[model samples]
Target: MSDTAPTAARTEAQTMLIAFDGSPEARRALTYAAEFLRPRRVEILTAWEPVHRQAARAVSMSGLRQADWSPSGEGEDPAYTEARETCREGVNLAESLGLQPRAHMVECATSIWSAIVDAAKELRVDLIVSGTRATSGFRGFWQTSTSENVIQNCGVPVFVVPPAEEEPDADC
Candidate 1:
């Protein structure tokens, strides 16, 4: 078998928030999202850091705390750059999936989690979807994971695509 299960798992979407970060998992999620949001208007929320112009003003300039990290402050312009990459990737994938999608770059402070939540609130998304590992292993960001922080914070339904075991090499 192809090591991957049927992609017919995810349901259709009225409004979905595909969190794109240019990761493989995010890409895979892109595929699943395509299926779910096919031909539908999907919102691509890509989170980014803001320019930290004032961070240097702090005497200590210490590392940010969790809360501070979330809405703490904006980072460098590179934050939006990363978000842009995600949007670009999402646009390509969405078209491939036959989905009519619009992209929104969420430039915020701290991490993707915080940015996602902010976007959700601002956009008033009905649902959220993404690809994730089946379990929260050491590298299981796609699994029940930190990415799920969006679920915890956002008051929206999130559908996470369970990870599948890659098929063993046929060359073996």
Candidate 2:
């Protein structure tokens, strides 16, 4: 027999939650997770915020009531449907890559990052995967990027895939 050594053991992620928003960046994150992590349990989460709309009734000068609004949809909030659809796409993509993934849609009136962090905690995922379109300069400082927020707030390990850079237009 040859004197060859065995390769080191590979570390596996037991459970991973992928933040999917049906965006290109999100898809890239999912793709990275599928190719690299390939966790036994994959959770695809899509968070949606409801749109605020004022009630149709006329407002009285004496008092003002809370605005009545829901997501745009037929009978149900459309945001829910969109979130579900986004999750479905993520699940299908992951499944196609031979991973068994579950889809989850969370509705939140606040920040989407908060929802993602909450889900990760509740699911007890070993890792959280997300895509980042890193912003720079003044806007980046003023705005709290979702991926950065998740990374900062999440307790579990977070894997972030930065969006691929596009080549500058020659005409410019």
Candidate 3:
């Protein structure tokens, strides 16, 4: 055997919560995080909702009320099933990446940004990582730059991973 010195051990464990939605941008974040942070623990989070659950239930039960259109797709909405499946897909994607996460399914009650802030609070995480949707034109960029929810409300630092193809065009 040769006489060689070993590397020193790390004292602190850096941790960050990565919000996964099965987007390529999320995967890119994981890769970049592994390179940049080398975190000892990674918590992957996903947000879901039943947007107007209470309202829908009340509307159905009350004779004087009529059905209302909710973008988040609550009761009897065609998008509800798809949303549920998408959330499941997100969780599965996280698990497949070797991250044993604490799954949470919120009744489509609050905004996604708010939900993320709450999750970070509950987990006591130091950072929040998420992805922005693909944008092509001036209007799209404007929308991406003006988000004031989940990402902005969190007290901790937030890092958003943009799609590789959309990186040059994205504001984040």
Score every model by TM-score: 0.65, 0.79, 0.57
* lDDT winner between candidates 2 and 3: 2
Residue-by-residue lDDT tens digits, candidate 2, 36-88: 77565688899887544223223433367656555454686655667788889
Q: Which is the better candidate, 1 or 2, if ranked by TM-score?
A: 2
lDDT of 1 by residue, 1-172 (tens): 4544334333343567788777777778778766654536688777665545334324235654422333354554665666687789888888778777788887665566777888878887877776665555575653346457877988888867665679999999
Identify the candidate with maximal lDDT.
Answer: 2
1-172, model 3: which lDDT tens digit per residue? 3344322233134457877555677667766665565554567665554536646655776865766675543356544555556556665655666554444544435456776677789888877777666565887755543123665678887877666763465565
lDDT on C-alpha atoms for all candidate structures:
0.69, 0.80, 0.60
Model 2, residue 130: distance off in Å is: 0.3
Report the alpha-carbon TM-score of model 2 versus the true structure.
Answer: 0.79
Cα RMSD (angstroms) for every candidate in the order listed: 8.6, 6.6, 8.8
Model 1 stretches astray by more than 4 angstroms? 1-13, 36-39, 50-76, 133-144, 168-172
Clashes of each: 7, 0, 5
Better of 2 and 3 by TM-score: 2
Clashing pairs in 3: 49-108, 50-107, 50-108, 51-108, 113-150
RMSD of 1: 8.6
